[model samples]
Target: MNKENREVVRPDGTTIHYTVTGPADGPVMALVHGWGCDRRDFDAITGFLPRHLRVLAVDLAEHGDSRSTRDVWTMEEFARDVAAVLEAESVGSCVVIGHSLGGAVAVETGRLLPGVVTRIVALDALHYLSLFPAQDECAADALLHPFREDFAGAMRGMVEAGSPPGTDPALVDAYIEKMSAVRQPAGLSALEGLVSWDMDAALRETTQPIVVFAVRAIITQEAIDRYGDRVRIETIELGSHHFHVESPEATAALLAAEMSA
Candidate 1:
């Protein structure tokens, strides 16, 4: 695929890097990678997508090729980074898709650009921590403790938790290594932002339809029932947490189906 590497600067002086493919006049679709991941994660996914659909894969501040000098690392801030990208590209309307943490960012992106973003798609996102009720102070602290103390060890535990019975050991190891290598303060701060995000509130303010393609083995009935009225939850047997990365063709089919609908 022929892609143009691009950069956009937000109001906070954060420089977001992104890759664009397909015709500028083509219907738009934005891809946001998960936490500790970059735009390249969607490289295969984009190839499997509809050829005429213009795709923008972004590297959020301090992640991938993006850089930032800002202190606030909230999902809203991340959405603003994406908003800047869209603004720079002069995209009038687009569907925003995000994976894991990017899911939260996608929701906020819809909230931030309700007029510009038509819908939100979450890949293995918005079911667990993102949708779960906000953690109390003590609970939040406990969750942060492990990462603050031993980031690598905690990253391993998280990767394992997201995997199901038959996932490959080598795949899990690869995820652990990649995630553990995320930049220091930004990685931790982003986690903090997610832990503190209020999904319910965001949903209340967001009018765009949201759909989640969550791992069937991991997503709970409680999650489906709790937000079913507001968001669509579709379970899949596709690998593990990083299912989109593992199964791009099928993922692209699903996404294309959604967009066509």
Candidate 2:
């Protein structure tokens, strides 16, 4: 499959960057990366996908090559960034797959385009109780205080939290380095947007079938018990929160199976 790099100008004049592969007329699958990550995270996964499925891996504004001057950093705004790519391509229907923070963006995409989005797939996303569950104003502020005070330290802590036992220390360090370098205040602001987001409200509004592929080590039973009835929760022991990167072929297979089903 030939991969084509492209950009779409949003209504707000932000240039959203993305990569497309496989047949243009094939069924569309839009892959959204987690915070501090870009579309390249899905490069290996896209390579493993069936030739007939068109894959659009997007770099949300201020992430990767996508540039944005917009002030808003909410999940809904991020969803619109993805929506702009779909609209530019004239995509009729697509399965929106998001990783970590991207998972929240996927839900918002479903809500924004109920008729266009058929399904939502969350890769190690939406199951973190501390992050997903709605937080009170004070609680949210407290959780964000560390990041506000020391962004680099908070990012390192985040990488450590996602990494399980036996995970390579080098890999953890690499992730921390990459994530910590995210463009200026946008990275910090995006983190604030995610931690403060109302997951309950987003879930309430999005009616699409959501499948969560959670990392076994990090996912809490409490999270499953709470959202299992609302979303399909499947735990996988293949990798950590960044499982798709650790096990691309397996992750691609899961996505392919869902897309086919």
Number of backbone collisions per candidate: 0, 0
lDDT for 149 (candidate 1): 94
- Cα RMSD (Å) between model 2 and the true structure? 1.0
Q: After best superposition, candidate 1 residue 154: deviation in angstroms?
A: 0.5
Q: TM-score for candidate 2, please give it.
A: 0.98
Measured by TM-score, how close is model 1 to the native structure?
Answer: 0.97
Cα miss at 167, model 1 (Å)? 0.9
**Which tens-of-lDDT digit does each residue in 58-146 have in candidate 1?**
99999999998889999999999899899999999999999999999999999999899999999988889532457778888998899
lDDT tens string, model 2, 1-261? 899999998866589999999898999999999999999999999989999999999999999999988888988899999999999999999999999999999999999999999999999999987776667788788878998899899989999999999887888888899998899678888877887788888898888999999988998889988999889999898877788988899999999999998
Give stretches of model 1 more than 4 Å off: 130-132
lDDT (CA) for every model shown? 0.91, 0.91
Residue 70 lDDT, candidate 1, scale 0-100 = 88
